[model samples]
Target: MRPPVEVCVFLLSLLAPGVLYTLNNVPALQEPLPILGIGMVVLGSLLLLLLFIVRHKTTLDPLFYVFAEFSFTCLVGLTNALEQDGFISNFMGFYLKKGEPHLSTAYAVMMSYWEGVVHFVLFLTMIRRMFTRKSYRSLGLLWAGSSIAHQLVHVPGVVIGKYGSSLRPAFWRNVPFFLVPFWAAFLLFSRPRETPIVTADKIASEQKKSLLSRPVDLLLSLLLLGAAAFSAFRGFVVLDCPLDTCFTYIYQYEPYLKDPVGFPRVMMLAYLFYALPLLAVMLCGLNTPGCSWMLDWTLFFAGAMAQAQWCHIGASLHSRTPFTYRVPADKWWPVIGLNVLLAAAPALLALRCHARPAYFMKPVPKGEANHKKKKN
Candidate 1:
């Protein structure tokens, strides 16, 4: 069977850019803006025509929009890789060049390679959701969270580095990347909550002890809280906290902390916000039986933490940040290990939530069921 009209149109919209990019390889309009304009115009025309043709056939699926946004994000990431490879250097490499002494070239190259692989996987995930009609709620939330985190860094990184004023096309084009993912997240959040299967054994276990009462759970919670505190403190340091001994040590030893512009600074703020609420929710949440939102929150945090850690580790150890902030060689093991742990914590939480999902399930509200019945 064919996919829905909305799905087909969205897929075409994705392919349109590549066709335009290839067509613009002609001799007349090789320059970035002219080529970009031609591509946008063609893409716009195609979408308009498709919308007209499919107006009656189109079906609404809010989740599909989220997947579509992710697919686009992957395309953007691939385009970034091309820019790094000098295929679209003029239009894309400005920020990479400007970030030289401040940002790491090694990091950028690695990030490009990483994005190329990741975007492909994400695109496949979208295809699966579209054609197979399967639910990947946890994965969906992770994609949304990571997209949001990446933008949190990227938007500021561009504005502060070379993009300058918000008026520039360079700056404005990126706005959609941020907006679409956030809208996707909101759509996912608004969906009706579901109840996981609850068995007699699960109920008995819940009555036995609080989730946090376990030693491992308590340890993980405290560690997560500590990491959140450190993130907030480091963000403060980036914003020019008074240079006391500890701050001096951070600036000297953990040099990325001294990012002149607010790129890493802004990212840290995003991480801090996610981490703080996450830590609080997890702490209180472990004890509260069957809070349906637990699964959603876990998935979101897992995605955010994974992306934030990726950015952090890359920014710290890779080529961009000033040499002063580089982690001292002697401390490498401890520092690197902690960052990896930070990334791993949320993934573990998401897995745990998924495995024993009944702990976090919530019953469908009577009103919603009644409405569904009436509609049927």
Candidate 2:
């Protein structure tokens, strides 16, 4: 199979069931389908695990994969619980059917919040790894501090619930999700200016001579920038109706979404605002002799896109429809078209820029020569 086709199959195996649950109405498929869907997701995740093991011989960022897997599991578990309880009878119908209280709801909510926390930790780690030692240390402290504050809120919530208190802690326990971007903004704003590592003279005279040179590098950087911007914008803005009161109700009804509008908006703005500085660092590192900064950035970008899609699906559940927003048959064609383009663009761009091949190369100098010597 073609690489693109393989990737599509992999993604569809993970995403199709959730999408179907959200956009269809088939009773027999309601409960069993999510189980089957989650099975596929687990299969895909295992495949990722195998790939990581065989290739990296260590691990993909554990933080990224763990949070992603937990998110999928929670989603599937929630759907199954809701369906069995008859809260969701058919795809389009919702009615409260009381039964023995299930701890799955609380578990699912806690997992969801932790997923956000893990995401913040992952990004902060990525930024730290990409920058200087001093910057890394400073950001590490900030991440640790924010994490403590976030969990402090959760402690009261957990304790109060256990003590038979009717009052629940505020939903702002999830605010760390947005606070991450705010901290990133502070880092960006306070960062000192620096001169470009590659001089115009070098680019004009030497670096532009070959296909694998400065121009190609610049193009790849721009593509990465564009992909990141598109993903962030879609995540923060496009998926929701701007004027819908549902936005307010999401925070009011779902304790998780409280203070939704302002935080997300601020986070999104911070992401956009920091893009240039981050891109500059990426480009500088890419231009260095032995650095694989481009590949690192691409991985971060792809992970962010996946996280955004997950968030989009999760937030959609907060709507009045609550998982029965159907896409018309006619609309499917366009939606599929858009999804295809969105998924394809990043893969193609990565391939064209040789980013993936470079990623598979060992990070140490003379890595290939050393391997051959050991083999001999």
Q: Which candidate number maximizes lDDT?
A: 1
Q: Write candidate 1's Cα lDDT for 1-376 as tens digits.
A: 6566446645654673465355434546554455446545754666466556445645745555445444543554566556555566443333333222222233344445444456446645655665556665556677777777777776666566433443233234566667887887887687765544454455446546664566656666777676666666766766667859447746555666555545666666666666767767776676676676778888887877777777678768754455666687777787788778878877887777777776555544556655665776
Q: Which lDDT values do the candidates have, in the order given? A: 0.60, 0.39
Clashes of each: 4, 0
Estimate the TM-score for candidate 2. Answer: 0.35
Candidate 1 local Cα displacement, residue 145, angstroms: 0.9
**For candidate 2, what is the lDDT?**
0.39
- Residues 1-95, model 2: lDDT tens digits: 22332233234335523653653444443343343453455557655753553353243333333233433433443444455445653422211
Off by over 4 Å in 2: 1-77, 80-167, 170-219, 228-267, 274-276, 283-289, 313-373
lDDT of 1: 0.60
